[model samples]
Target: MPTLRRTLGLLAIPALALATALPATATAATAAHADTASSRTVLPDAAAAGWLARQLVDGDHFESVFNGTAYPDQGLTIDAVLAFAASRSSDEAAAKATAWLAKPEILSGYLGDGTTEAYAGATAKLLLAVEVRGANPASFGGVDLPSRLRSLQTTEGRFSDRSQWGDYSNAFGQSLALIALHRTPGDAPTAAVDFLANSQCADGGFPLSFGQPTCAGDPDATALAVQALAATGRTAKANTGLDWLAAHQNADGGFAAAGATTSNANTTGLATQALLSGGRFGTGLKGWSRLVKFQQGCSADPAVRGAVAYDATGFNAASGTRATAQAVLGLAGTPLSTLSAAGARPDSPTLACPAPATR
Candidate 1:
């Protein structure tokens, strides 16, 4: 039998100030306003946005594919959450993030799926997430992490498996690892930085992997790398990536995943995050506004509400929490903010989160 997993909890505090500050009439009036006018061009204040960020921060836990069981490994999810949470100065969120990093599974690897070796990129992301949440440098697993990180490096200076490398050279893995290395307060080799600069495609975006036919940089992957580079004081390289992203904006004021056939909340959200990291907040704000419109409540559909859903040609009722989380993540630059605002929370203990077999 297939096992069930409960990844994260939904802890929402009511936005009493937001609700009370705006009377029912004003709220309804704003809802009735046109998308252009209703979508605030300015990024929401960090405090105003904290509630949503918390939702994103807490929703990172998902079931481990190994051992046919569920476990909370924030390593995979905390980078993005910490970015948003740190911006808001959320003390509670910081504490939770710190606790997750201190978990043994992060550095030593989780005890499932045959004790798979921890990936360099995953470990790097976890470390950055912890720091963003306000953990001390000592809170990291100490000198062991740097040694393990070095071990994952290829002779070419890129990280990840040589044969099946995916997105490492192109800013995804390198970016996260760079942030971890930068935060460790030790001398890092120049080769790693050199590898990132060399991986840039002629079009100015990073690919999902090195030497793949598709050199098109994905918005989400690019965003991850952009932030990583920025963290490591590589502002110029980060700017180039951001420039490429800005050039790729669609006519709809949003971003396409790669080739620009369609705009998606996932790609758009990442683009927004990247832009924010690069200090291009104005450009990111426009894209985010467009995304918020796309994620407007699912009143037109019954299976999902207040969440984004996708289908090639027909609606798929089976898509569940993962889709919701992705859409929420895509919309808010963090997960759970929009979901809470819409009053929908992930159902615990086997919340259905199925992605399409093929994207």
Candidate 2:
């Protein structure tokens, strides 16, 4: 297992400022109004814990599916999958990630052609793979991943556009690149941190694009940026983003995706992880507890429980195991207490694989 290291920095800002500046109303009213506290309540204890454990075990299978199918596309979906894989410490996931590290097709598709989405996702995945798998960052065909990463830089310290791909002003894209740079050695991490810090909106949230009309500080983008910042040793910046997340939690306790009405397990899981990464455990616990409640038992609602069917949107909801893995990683931040009592270890499961490949 990779040792988690902490870095100290000097960018303190009161959490109150964050709460005041990024008020819940700043999020879309339509999105906020749609959520109801009644629909989002705590689940029975057995059901919640079981859901979390099952998800952790199933995370292994999700990585397998992603490596086999989604990874070939080299998109944001793959990036998210890799982040989840690393968090769960999937066994064979490292092998598939190593394959991606070695594959020029995957690298060039994103970095060489200026595919912003792919570049962001692939960069994040590669960084996490190195950290979790202990893979040699430089061993893959002498590929200078850092240099390829630097190629994405724009004059503003953010990535610029290539081949008429429009302005590269996406927070999601920048966050992934920042995460990659943070994991790589040298000044790239510093530059990435500077870029992200300067990009923070007055609301303490981050906009998806620079100077774009839709650039309201959003929860999804903010969460990604917060995690990237935390990974890079900028805890204060990460905390500011987390404060925004805390305020965005619906009355029911789940997070909405950039002020969207629909609160799915996937975005909630990401936001929860980001909050925990920033050391905002109190808020993380609340959000996570709510998500656990949603997964109480097999149900028709994808939010309440894992889905029986497979769709791109609900891919993460395929099984109770998938949701459980994500929630456990997000909330517990370590192996389940129950697992330890049963003589099972963190990042390792003794359960037989579930059938039908839920989701």
Candidate 3:
């Protein structure tokens, strides 16, 4: 028997295989299968965790959703690590992931990229991930991840990055920064709360960027802003944003991004967590229902079990890992700030696997 490190559950959807790993075109069976009413509804946590668990490459790491290979994809690995720990489905994988992250090579590239220099979003996310698993961000992997995050903060309390993807470095990264710094309140920027509150649009939602002459509400950014505001006991503000979100829920029980034409599991999952954080589950349940249907189950091909498509359009590897992983958070009803241990880590079931085919 394999020497078990700790309890672990992961899933690998065949629909999630890297684009290069498959033929030039998606097969009809894989592309045409959509979640219908008759589809068996599995626990969102179980379905997503099972899928996340199977994707572990070695005893310690998750395969990249982008390449379907076992490389040092620490940036993406953090999502699965936090998801498994939050769902109580895989402690071993979480622990092993923590161990793997302690290595220097995997983290070196994440230090920065593009014009913004430091990968500010990556650093903030890692801080949140380490904290989620009960690990110390201050000393994880030789460098203090939390300290690194704070160093990136501006005096204005805005955690902005002006890089190639700098446009994406606003509310999303700022939200994570606020949550991570909350773990160490003293060190967190005092102006952080106000920064987020100021980002809110007249519609009671927040935009993905700051300094916009006008407020344009983004579903994803609004959701995260709600959670971040709630952390500071700003229920009045949080509720305002939540109300905007409530009004925007698509009849299908899901939400789209600020300007997107279609609703997606990824946005729904994110909004779900934010609503739960603000104590607004009543408005979020329909979306939750829509969210769960995205996961593949026994009725689907065995290889695709536990997979979650981004939306009804069907599953695509491009969005599978991120969409499913985020869905698990909503399915479990645990927000990013509340993902500490509820069930013991040892209580999770195991998924059998072959030895790592490659490092």
Candidate 4:
């Protein structure tokens, strides 16, 4: 999947070695939110994560197909890493995916070689992923991911793409940049936080793109922005964004992208996590309830069971990967800023279906 970003915007770990490698802030943050998943059993979360793990090629990476050719999909792979960490299941898959991403060639392609302009969103996201897996971002793939991302920041404080392709970095990029940097040495800079906080639309939500003539709220952008703003201690801004999300929640408890009336698993997953981050547990659970309905449960074909579909229409291969990757975060009820794989299981666990009742 190219991600909703391509359509609209854009778009791992160990144990003792991990523990020693992780920053104190990351360790502490992980500890504080460790119980976030306790409010619900989430047997479905585990199964969904399990099914997601199986979709990775070679138990490590995912591929994006174009026409008849397949290319390594580093972006989607990172999404899987986050989902695995959030669910606290499929630890091995998350670690393996992390390692795969840390490869020199792969890392270079996604983040860009110095000859090519570095991507703010990709760098920030990868930094967060490596950190979440408890790996050192400074030394990952023999490059300093955090430092690299910092270098992309503008004088005005936005973490922008230094790209020949034009700066496609959006609110999602800014949010990831803030969140990833929050775990690093000095935390996100004041200017960067202010830049994002100030960009909020009048509707009490964030826009997908910056520098637009008129700001319009986008569900996916607003959700990710809320997490970053909350992590950075911009409580007022975060709460306002949450208010916009709450206002947009459909009667079915799911959320749709900006300007769309139909609810989708991707937006619901993100908005639910935002709600949880804002401490709106009841509202978050409502989003969760709607999100799970998009999942293919026991009634689905064996290959697709536990996979989340993009919409109520049900599961299809095209949208399955992205939907499942994003949805698991909400289903597991873990906010992205504090997500880690510290105590996750090494194996993917299948759904446990109960026996049919006898007449």
Candidate 5:
């Protein structure tokens, strides 16, 4: 029941945003108003979903199969799930790609190669995917997702992990952990919220690490945190961070990744959600339209019809997998939580939130 309720709640955010985003006028009026109107690009929802649909390998798996780079099927598959959900893709191809990710083998891979101990961040991501898709994370791939996500939170309020990635997944993991747990029945720990909120640098952007000494705001991390906070009803607290993001949009209709700050689709896609959350999509319309420009159309190749590019330079099979997945969500005007579904029975007598450490 908790999961079902969360699902219905999430399905409304983007619909509201998109309605607000459309121009009040018709074609000629919109054409004349382009100079000042705040609107979503002309990109069709089906085209974006179709591009992601083509990336699925075999009938069930998606891979960076084209980009020469081999990303773990686990991460790529999760992205596919979000892409389908945000676009509300109901075609046969969309169903197959989503179904493939539900397989036990694929879910286990998120924990890592089945032979090794699971990575907390990977597991959290899979749990999020399961929840968003209305799958039972407690029994997903033979493990309980909500329980494992809780165990990963440390006493200090960090979803700290020393997995092989060496804490690299900390910022992302913390944000995701909060979001995944938010879908269940309970207040996501106040400490966890503070942990993510305090991670913000003076610039109002969060770094990849919550406690880094010289951390700068990152488009990806900051944008992600924005979605988590917005979905969880902390939008006021997340405002400054959203403002920082709006301020940084490049003159081009896009945003840059951390460090490089060059306009790119991935960052733009992620940031677009934050902007929408802040009700500042008009301020960042250029950035949003910049992403529309990144989409590969049938003119290029009907086979890659809706593939989104990483940068204006053009699409690369390698980076496009993640970038396109992330981009589609932003383009669809949804957040990371839009994919969250019921992972466990929070109503169960035995289901309990982990107690936060006493300060």
Candidate 6:
């Protein structure tokens, strides 16, 4: 068994993987109608978290059913757990989801079967998630996740996957590794920090894939890197990454992926949290507004109301789960590295749009 490090319920979402727009001058009429349509007793964050909790399979986890086969979606489930923690709502649902992730059968598949292969990113992400839930990662499912992740570190300090197939770890995995290690009693190795810092593209953003012929900065990767480096006391490095992200923000205050001009909730959500962590308050608030625009209000089906859409096309069952899970972080103004579920509500609340006033 490895040395157990217990972080107090400060859970975070992994690199699950966003839009833009103004309400005042650009579209005053649309803004007023949106406000009236979204009149709710519950806060948007709480309502969004509530809708997310209700989507869990068995009120605990999510399933990726493919061709009639139901496979446990531990990654997506962890995203929900972190989102619940960030919003400080749906404590019961978060706890249940966390518990489900700790099951030996479920844990094995996600972190790998232990004997055959181990996923560096999944291990790091799970470590971070369980710690946020206030659980002991060392003792989770009878495996030491932190220790397991440590074993996968490369000579270059990047955490690589251990598999017969190939090494699939990337910048996202490296960021998660640094973050999870930072929360523990031990500091992330200096070598690991150096490796991450050295990987920054000339554009000041981090790339989704490492060692490409040419470095291409990705918004999602850059956001996670900012949070990780900042959490580890690398403020200057983190700020440079933030600068890159800021440079890429759309006119509507949301972000788009690299080479894509359209803003979406998933990227914007991650970037919003990074902005807050990096002290870019004005930009972060703008990101929040963009995320709000992606949310489905009461006019949509009740089941999907409060759920965020991926882009302007509106919410669909396939993409809504991932979109909402990521968006809640921004909607709640909760940064991933410091998210906690303490003092959260046990129940998920519904959006209550008041009846339209008759003219």
Best candidate (score: TM-score): 6
Tens digit of lDDT per residue, candidate 6, span 1-359?
00100111111111001002442464543553265234556666677889999999999999888999998999999989888887778999999998888888999888887666999999989898887888888899899988898888889888998888888899899999899888888768778988898899987999999999999899999999988898888888899999999999999899997789999999999998788657787898778778877877766777888888898777788999999999887777666676667778899888786677899
User: 75 in model 3: Cα distance from truth in Å?
Assistant: 3.0
Residue pairs that clash (backbone atoms under 3 angstroms), model 6: 10-132, 11-132, 18-263, 18-264, 18-265, 18-266, 18-267, 19-263, 19-264, 21-252
lDDT of 3 at 289: 66
Backbone clashes, each candidate? 4, 8, 13, 4, 10, 10
Candidate 5 residues lying further than 4 Å off, grouped into runs, are: 1-43, 64-72, 90-95, 113-116, 162-165, 339-359
lDDT for predicted candidate 5 compared with the true structure: 0.65
lDDT of 4 at 336: 72
Query: Could you give candidate 3's per-residue lDDT for residues 304-331 as a string of tens digits?
Result: 6666788777778767878877887766
User: Lowest summed lDDT over 10 consecutive residues: which window, candidate 3?
Assistant: 1-10
lDDT score for residue 183 of model 4: 92
TM-score each candidate.
Answer: 0.62, 0.62, 0.79, 0.87, 0.77, 0.89
Q: Residues 1-359, candidate 1, lDDT per residue (tens digit)?
A: 00100100000112223433555567542342222122232222222223333344353333334577656645434533443442233334444445555666644553111124446666555545554544554436443555556667777778663223233334566776776676666744568866776677777777767667756677766776666666666778778888988888777667777655676655765676567445575676566555444432312232332333332222233332233334434334432111111111222211122233685
lDDT of each: 0.49, 0.50, 0.69, 0.82, 0.65, 0.81
lDDT of 4 by residue, 182-212 (tens): 9999799999999999999998989999999
Top lDDT: which candidate number? 4
What's the residue-level lDDT of 199 in candidate 3?
77
The count of backbone overlaps in candidate 2 is 8
Q: After superposition, how far is residue 316 of candidate 1 from its true place, in Å?
A: 10
Off by over 4 Å in 3: 1-42, 62-72, 113-117, 162-168, 185-187, 341-359
- Give the TM-score comparing model 6 with the true structure, all chains together: 0.89
Measured on C-alpha atoms, candidate 6 has an lDDT of: 0.81
Q: Give the worst 10-residue stretch by lDDT in candidate 2.
A: 4-13
Candidate 2 per-residue lDDT over residues 213-240, each given as its tens digit: 5547887778788877777677787778
